[model samples]
Target: MADLSVNFAGISSPNPFWLASGPLTNTGYQVMKAFDMGWGGAVWKTVGEPVINVSSRLAAIDYGGRRMMGLNNIELISDRPIDDNLREIAEVKRRFPHHAVIVSLMLASDPTLWSDMMRRVEDTGADGVELNFGCPHGMSERGMGSVVGQVPEYSQQITAYAKSGSSLPVIVKLTPNVTDVRMPARAAVAGGADALSLINTINSVMGLDVETWLPDPHVADRGSHGGYCGPAVKPIGLYMVSALANDRRVPVPLCGIGGIETWRDAVEYLLLGAGAVQVCTAAMHYGFRIIDDLTEGLNDYLDRKGLASVQDLVGKAKHRVGDWNDLRLSYSYKTVAEIHADQCIGCNLCFVACDDGGHQCIDRLPGQRAPVVRKDDCVGCNLCSLVCPVPGCIEMQDIDLGLVETWRQRQSRVGF
Candidate 1:
């Protein structure tokens, strides 16, 4: 089997999967249990000043009978005392010496406080300290969390403070609520972060109780915007990770987070340039035992691809991501959707979708069950393929007219 171990920044793990900082890593009991279940690492939930949590702190967005497709929470950082958390961290590290034990921290903007916290965290024998600059809800209102992450200068300054206080690697966790994620990312790098992890929970209000007319997970009759995460945020996470990977200024390793549920999802993050992948909602939904499947599936995929190590897959697809101007504009280069009669279930879902939502390039015969594609009018939007219930029923065939030209080339040719 291919080696799945990864050395992210300076911390080595037996595998690339690590439990993200959240409710799961709040206690030593949970962290130890996760290590026993085969997780390679665990970032202890954000620790700092204590705060009381609301009775109703969780909310979910369910779709198509699926529960928690997206999870939103008003949850704050670790409410446990700093001393208790540090003691547990030390013990967990002693018991599982090989596993990566990282501590997530969020505090006020004071450099002394940050430096002091760093020194205390390092004393716990933890492998690294993750600056939790990305908490979007409760912490943000207090001039911390995403507040520090949203501003590039603050991110850099705080990271420098942490670096000055501890010799251990510093991983800055970035917020996704910003208009340009790269801004803070570049700032964190400037602050001397050894590595970066993102994207922290997005700001969102889960939903409203129609009957009560209150927000979801309301405290009594009031509701507030909370941090949003889960499967819904994967696309955003992938885009941000790819953006940083393609950037020349930010060269540090990336730890991908947001909506990773399966090994396939983890592989997608890896291919985009994440040295390691973090999980939260999925583990909360399906128990820690899922680690078995994650490790096994990733190993199987690597061996099948003739890869000797998981690191080989990192950034393999980064070059494939680029701006629209870089895309081929050649008229001869085209792709049209084709339906396989053998695989077609005679379901008109694709035909309906294409006619209504996409280009009207599909037609149904008077008596035929399967729809035919109009090659000339087909735009290859992939809408028909996406709506098809049967896999492989609709395939997009690329047509090469023996020509290639990009928008940039056309601009130069026009000499405008």
Candidate 2:
């Protein structure tokens, strides 16, 4: 059997699957349950001075009928007392020394506080520490999370402080709201962080009450921006991790996060060079048992691929990712939209998409420009094809530039 064990930051995990620090891993009870259920590791929820959470702290939105495709939360760090968390951490470590128990921390902006917390957390005999640098709401407003993560300097300084204070290795969780992901990853490395985990939930507003026209999970007449995480954020998170991994200078073990709901999602992260993968929203949505899919699915996939270990798959896809300019210009794809005239109800989604998105390829009725794609103008970009909920409304005609001198003339030849 292919071993799924992963060695990250010198801490070996039974598998690459890990529980991201969030509401799902808030209590020792939750952490113990997750470890029992097959997750290789768990980053305990952000802990600081105990703070009560709002009554309606979480909200969710579904995509394509998938319950909880995206989630939002205004919750702060661990509501459990700091002393209690430390005690549980000690006990959890005593029980499962082989599993990774990285205590996630959020505290005052001062270096002294971070230093003290790092020392205290290290006392628990936890394998490592993950600085919670990317919660976009509550704690962020208090200047303890994303506020610090957004600045490379602060991220670097705090990471350095934690490194100096803790005997255990440190992984800094990064915020994805920044313009470029490379900056902070590099900064963490500069500060001597042993590894990097990302991305924390993005800033988001859950939804609006159709009646009052206010955001839901509504607070008294108002709602604050919450951290957005779920299946939706996975792709974005993967991109950032890949970008950082691709950078030759920063090879810190990456704790991939975002929308990791299944084994397939976890594989993509590992193949993108993540030393391990983490999940929060999905666990919260599906319960700790979700790890059943996370582990079995990955193991099945590895077996099918004839691989013996998770390490074999890690970074297998990294080299395949390249700069936009290096993309094969020769790879030409035409728009292919299926029009289900019966189901379309003449919504004009395809027509509007073809017209506004790119070329006016889609043409409509004789009098009303119903948006039928003009085969000639359609670059086959597929924009029109995708919007046609009616199925195959506007289809892009595949163009082999070899058959047409157009692209050759557009590029190699200039108007003299």
Per lDDT, the best of the predicted structures is 1
- Stretches of model 2 off by over 4 angstroms after superposition: 330-358, 362-377, 388-416
Q: Tens digits of per-residue lDDT for model 1 on 1-416? A: 89988999999999999999999999999999999999999999999998778878989999989999999999999989999999999999999999999999988888899888988998899999899999888888899999999999999999999999989999999999899888999999998999999989999988887887999989998988999999999999999999999999999999999999999999999999999999999999999999999999999999999999999999999899978787886485888999987788887998999889998999998877889999989988899999898988999999887767778877898852
lDDT string for model 2 (225-248, tens) is 888889888899999989998998
lDDT of 1 at 325: 81
TM-score of each: 0.97, 0.86
Error of model 1, residue 88, in angstroms = 0.2
Alpha-carbon shift of residue 1 in model 2 (angstroms): 2.3
RMSD of 1: 1.4
Ten consecutive residues with minimal summed lDDT in candidate 1? 324-333
Highest TM-score: which candidate?
Answer: 1
Residue 105 in candidate 1 has what lDDT? 91
